[model samples]
Target chain A: MSKRSIIPGFRLSIGISVFYLSILVLIPLSIIFIKSFELSLAQFWDTIINPRVLASYRISFVTAFCAAIINTVFGLIVAWVLVRYQFPGKKIIDALVDIPFALPTAVAGIALTALYAKNGWIGSLLEPLGIKVAYSPLGIIVALTFIGIPFVVRTVQPVIEDLEKEMEEAAVMLGAYRLRTFLRVVLPTLYPALLTGFTLAFARGIGEYGSVVFISGNMPLVTEISPLLIMTKLEQYDYAGATAIAAVMLIVSFLLLLLINLLQWSMNRRMTANS
Target chain B: MAGVVRYHATTKKQTREKHIDESLVVRWTLISIAVLFITIMIILPLTVVMTEALKKGASVYFAAIAHEDAMSALRLTLITAFIAVPLNTVFGVLVAWAISKFKFRRKQLLLTLIDLPFAVSPVIAGLVFVLMFGAQSYLGPWLSEHDIKIIFAVPGIIIATLFITVPFVAREIIPLMQQQGITEEEAAVSLGAKGFQVFWRVTLPNIKWGLLYGIILCNARAMGEFGAVSVVSGHIRGRTNTLPLHVEILYNEYQFSAAFAIASLLMVLAIITLIVKAIVEWREEVQNIHL
Candidate 1:
């Protein structure tokens, strides 16, 4: 009668799901395991931790984390604005939030590169100010931000809209100040959505190449991302190394996301219990 | 009664909504900031790409667009997307139907597997296909012997794009299906409709809007896919290059206007998709209200 009945029956659908999963998911993931199997344990460790590889990992994860954090804070503000108030260009801004989602990563990257490249108008201005953007780690952050903003903004928007305003008014009527009401009342409802958006944007930025590559200038340790490092490894026919790096990324990303998911799950469960 | 609960919600929220109008000015300023970000981040750069694209004049732009390698890349991208999109759509609908309209063991596992593509990099996605279809794997030799090259061929592109994009349609459709109860199907069955007809007439019509949303997302991903497609494409200019790769080639070679011209075309298509998506989403919202 609930989530159960709506889906036909357990056994038959599970059987169908298994067949789909085997073809679609398991075999593909296993092949990565198999490819990495070519290397011994020490070789696996050596392959994944190559200095260039480590550099890429640092740049990618650091910039992605930074970008995700930026998106989380700014995106929350943006979502709050869209939800709590109506203004000129509100619908347009709402529509614009999806640009990063729909835009091609390569295209977005190229666009960012053009905007911030040495001779580019924006880049030219920044260059005169002694602030290098394109062809640096900074450029990588800008590109990732360009592509990942939508994930945070869109994810947070619906939840912000879903929040009941009466609750806010009640707290205000009870003499809680605006910031306190937001911190004590509004923030709680929006936290999980913010976390979800942050996680998704962070995950997206970590592996992002097309957008970052054009802008990063793909320097070995300076601006290169993990995915680009995998590409470089594979291009040099270092199949073992590439798969090893991928496997590491897989394991680490899986663990991290699993943690975030658990966090989200617990939060949702708490909300359900409270309500 | 349930009526009272509904009445309370409508009345309370309505009164509260009017008070919120008097609530904040900073909100609008922040929204304008968001709008500014999108404009600077997205629309401005796009306008630049277009401006640079047109600098060489129309004849040259058309010539660049008509360039054989670019033509082949565009065709190949479409060919792969066309093959992959329908297959994925069918797969998405089946998976959604099974997950939504039926119960299953390890259901969460299945959903997780389906959603894995979103979290993983597409570049890695290409590697997974290569691992299976390249010269090293079990099937690679068989596929190569058949002269049916998949790892570095059209099939490879399709498989890679499909892998990277599988979640798009299914994710879009599931929420709608959840909102839509299966009563209509049950009623159709009661009226003697077979499974096929029940699905053909009853199910498909209801979810068409959601399906379109997924398809647009899938098609866009397929066409614009660079990192994964680039890996598998072998960068063969006339052979494996998709439009994105072509743009990369032209830009790298300093054919700036030509590259932007082609890139601008793709942007036009993207803009069209965005417009269509906007409409469909609006329709979906309207439909939601009625539902």
Candidate 2:
């Protein structure tokens, strides 16, 4: 069987994939590293450490982190409802959950701004309460959370569907209460998937640009996200500064992604072993 | 003895009922929260896009969509998707096929590499291309000397889009192909079918739905991409600007109704995409049940 491969076009497939990946992804991405090298180490450090840049980072990280946390809690609830219970319009709700993935970020940005702008629908209501959503850090969280709603739901939905009810039943048979069975017996099994979803949402939130840019009001050192900072630098013809900031965002997200993959891999291994 | 046994039986039945599902109050409360969250987060924004677009009237909405700049942006967006989606679909197929059909070293690495774009910020995706083919880069001089433009042009838009969306089709198809395994193809080959014949007859039919699913998703993203395309588009109206960027331009210029009018068109596309996706998923599930 090993003497010759049975598959046809194997060589062609491998060749095209490798070549395409190199040109489209690998080669272009390497340019960031090469461009950043042109700046002296101190200059690179200074650009990223600039107070304005630091403020943007703080806003981006804090908002994205909050968005991820929010998504994890509510997304889990959504997933559980979709899996565990039947309701009117369940199918519609299931389909609607994916809108954030399908809708253009630009459209979402405008629509959200209109909704949350003072005197607008939700905004008018919030304004009466002296609460602001549009053109603030809160607005950033709103957009990030909007885009992030899908990640946790999609990740956790399948796990919930596949959950072994027998285990929960067994816990009950042992005289455990309903909430206790859920918290101790069910939630632990879901932790890995939940964490994966959280990181994915967080990573996407950190890099988000189009949706946040409008509603954020883009106030310097106040509402600017890191990705927008990269754009601001590019607009100002500060290639060195842009490259420095882009590189930093890129590395941090890559580490987060690596953690997600590790978690998924271990989860898959455990799943197969159990089966 | 009989009274004692009756008491124990009643308590046992109570425990079973309680343990099986959440109490009615808890269930309804969870449902209410999920519904309320979805309305505030997802449904309301969608309604706003449509209402705000029509706030002026039908004629204004029509004029906004028909304006030369809006028309140009729509055309450019379609063109970019026209180019990017097909190319990426082909690449996705090839990569998915290669990785699933063959075994080699560092296969995990290849999968991770494909996912790299997802992890990277969209702005950075555009920046790398700018750094590569921008006038400031090493190749910039060579490209300019050849009188060719990449960064801040249509080609740059397509390239950045390609970078951002390259993984969608492959990521969708890979696991599917992996799950289906190689048995069917081998069976066809043993029946004296050639490689191309086997693939076309056996493999293609099996993965057709999955491939369509991937293409739909890729098309949606290609058309909707804002951040990366914005970086490379240079925002030249009627020439380089795509729809998302055009929306940004109008909204920033305080043309609220017009901006939303154009945005409503894209939102329609998103809705249609969702509907189509739902149908595809339902059909796939039906097919799975039959199998």
Candidate 3:
């Protein structure tokens, strides 16, 4: 048998996959756009640009952005410490990093709310300091940060491990100090991975509903997120409004994902060229 | 040459000592921050789930979990996973086989299309279904005349879960099958093995671990899916409610102990998922080292 034709069922396999995805993913997703088209151009414009809708878009984007930034900094630190340092319970900490990914977001939501509520453990501590966490924009960020914790760590970890130690040694031999070596050599190489992680986390955070809903207090124009707004509209039977807002969020998320894929492709190319 | 070598070694030793002294401080500081951050962010929530669940004592915790609605929610969650995971797995395997074994055009686009669910918001995922099949959609009236309901029903929940889990198994298997190549299958075919026989004997064994890894991940998300399931569930107690939704209802009703109790079950599931994941990765690594 020719190697190319050795495995049969190519036609059957591809046909089934495309048909399955079309039914489950593509066709349903297309409904968002089609349904939203029920609104006139001006009506669609008014629905999306409503102040409450605008506020939600702002809140969701801003909080997700802040959370991604937080994860990028702290996630990089966690990834670095896990890679470079040998601490007691290192394995345990490493395992725990994936908790956010594994845990149901609703569980995380209520658990985090319990921990950060006014009478809750950490919230009680922060209450005396006048720093409210739960039921505020800050709480939204916390939920998002928790949701996104693994993205940066998992994305940057293998890259950090695969990093050439010899490069750092060479820099040291050239009279660069420890700080300089990392800042000049290590940080530059990590930028693409960090950015990719940041984008993923940000994308996830923007659409996050389960975790953020509990902590965000659901206050309209203040704590209301875009996803929650969609939920609210659906609950009110405002299907047109719901699909309109959903369409906008969908477009932004798709753009962000496309960017990440492009970034990953380039990163892979760079690695191959270097090796 | 000997004198120069000696001088170089002395300078290197001196610089190393100084560097260690300074780097030690930086290292410990970073480690402390990382440890403290994780403890607060990850561990504290985990601890709270258990503590709050048991706050009213073990009896209350057990009572909460054994409640009629809670049990039904669990049943519903299992059913959703039971249906969704297998369908996705079959589709995943077929997609992986087609993409990996053949040199095809627009392969990248195919992969991207497969990953489309990962990018989509769960709320949007549910909304898409509602838009497509809900009572207000184009198909809704005709479906109602036929007495068939999709949205706000079990089918909707399953569809949303399937949408969210579409990429898992295929993603896991694709690269693995590609790396393993078609050599073994070709060898089996040359020896007069038939198509299904080649796949069953040669291809399945080589990619089993990755396939399992994918299934585990798909099942985890399938069981834990909240937002997508939530939208279509309609929150009808004991009927459409899944486990996560049950937690939300109990929590919202100020049944704190009950909510956490239900949540604790999911917490355990998540932890078990992590342990299994770690084991799989370790086995893969060990296999690689042996090879």
Candidate 4:
């Protein structure tokens, strides 16, 4: 008798998947590069390097970096607390960490605008200190940080939970103080996860548009982000300009995410080896 | 008796001196900081959505969502999600099966390509469609000649949504199925089960929860998608305006109450998505324990 294959329909399934992915993802993404190439080198350089575009790129990168840093610090704290402590409404707090993931970005934008507008709730409090959040670069950072929080918290939480408390106990038993034990024993273990979270947050922040637009005020050469600038170019029917900016974003973000994944893979290997 | 009393005293002293956990002050401080951050960043925004929606009273809020354009926007959002979610769901299952069950060359590259959409900016996702089908492209003239409009129309909205959410279901299911392995299916096949029968009887039961979770997330994203859909939607009121676009129009028109009211509806959907997600996670945990 002929031996039958264990998993049937491999050809059919692979065919459909390859065809669908090519049409929906591969082909469309390639069009961006091809369309951008339609411009000569000088045109591409001018489109991407004009003063306004440069300013927007700077603002996008700076704010995203700042937001990612802030998220790393607070996200670690949040993840640490959720994994180690028992508190009232713990489940709800855990659920709330994912609100940004599930919440519509547009809704987040409007709600944040309402809270931080000069006359809004939080805005009223900060205004006394001459701090403006809504319609400024600060507002853009706030929105990015809000959306990026879950990335850090979720990434680090499982690692924290899986950590063996025995190592910490042994350190304490060796006469290490609380702060010393955490710094030496715990921080090294968490460093890779923290870095991964930071990179992911930074990557997402770079491409974020919906939540940042209303809060950013879109002031050219000031608060304009690369994504918003791309939108403006599209609205004006500047397809080449739009695709050029988008291609730059795509390359930078793709490289950053690839680096992060590599870091994570290596970290996983080290962790399993140590255990 | 004297030795026993001395041992008790030493044990009490050790208990007092050997406390290794964080100080009460430090613990409370960290907890408070976490709570404060969450409140300011997450909780505040959620409450603000509801408060602002009702700031002008319930009647006005109700009227805002009941407006003709609002209803049409709601319908369009539902229609687009209904089409996009199922299409992606089927595609997700097929892709997950291929990658998890079969060996292939360039497997890692295929996986990364699948995730390309997530890394790409949503604006870019929308732009690619326009570049391919807008009035300026090669297909544009041909499609227009046939009276088929893909850009600035319902078809454009659906395509953009599809692109943005294409990876959600597959990403969720691939790892799950990989962990499950194929031994059960292999055994069932060797026992005389047909392809469809084996999948339905053996694989489907194991993956149904994960599939549902993925579908919920994909549907939420499809319904809430703004950036990509906004780029191609043309913002035609009562025509191509999805719910998010409608919120944008109302906000831009200086109708704050109406905008927040419409936003609150989406917020409710977000809440429901989170609840379902939590339940699915809990169910998965229970199943893992059983295993």
Each model's lDDT comes to 0.79, 0.90, 0.91, 0.90
* The candidate that achieves the highest DockQ relative to the unseen native structure: 2
TM-scores for candidates 1 onward, in order: 0.92, 0.96, 0.95, 0.95
Clashing pairs in 2: none
lDDT of 3: 0.91
Relative to the real complex, the DockQ score for model 3 comes to 0.68
Per-residue lDDT tens digits for candidate 2, residues A177-268, read 99999999999999999999999999999999889998999998889899998998999989999999998888898899889889899989
Candidate 2's DockQ = 0.77
Q: Which candidate is the best by TM-score?
A: 2
Q: Write the per-residue lDDT of candidate 1 for residues A1-275, one digit (tens) a residue.
A: 34545323345545665676678667897889887787899999887678988887899899999999988887887777776665677777777777777767777777778889888868988987899999999998888888788887887887766677679889878877777888898888877888888888898888787888788888887877889988887788777888998898887677656766676677669667866
For model 1, the stretches where C-alpha displacement exceeds 4 angstroms are A1-17, A267-275, B1-25, B289-291
lDDT of 4 by residue, A1-275 (tens): 14445788788888998899999989999998898789999999999899999998999999999999999999999999988766788788899998888888999999999999998899999999999999999999999999899999998998897677679889988999989999999989899999999998998899998999989999999999999999999999888899889989988988986887688789879977987
Q: Please, what are the lDDT tens digits per residue for candidate 2 over residues B137-238?
A: 899999999999998889999999999899989998898899889888878888889967877898889888888878988898999999999999899999
Weakest 10 consecutive residues, lDDT, candidate 1 chain A?
A1-10
| RMSD in Å for model 2 | 5.4
Each model's iRMS: 2.8, 1.2, 2.3, 2.3
User: Any runs in candidate 4 off by more than 4 Å, and if so which?
Assistant: A1-5, B1-20
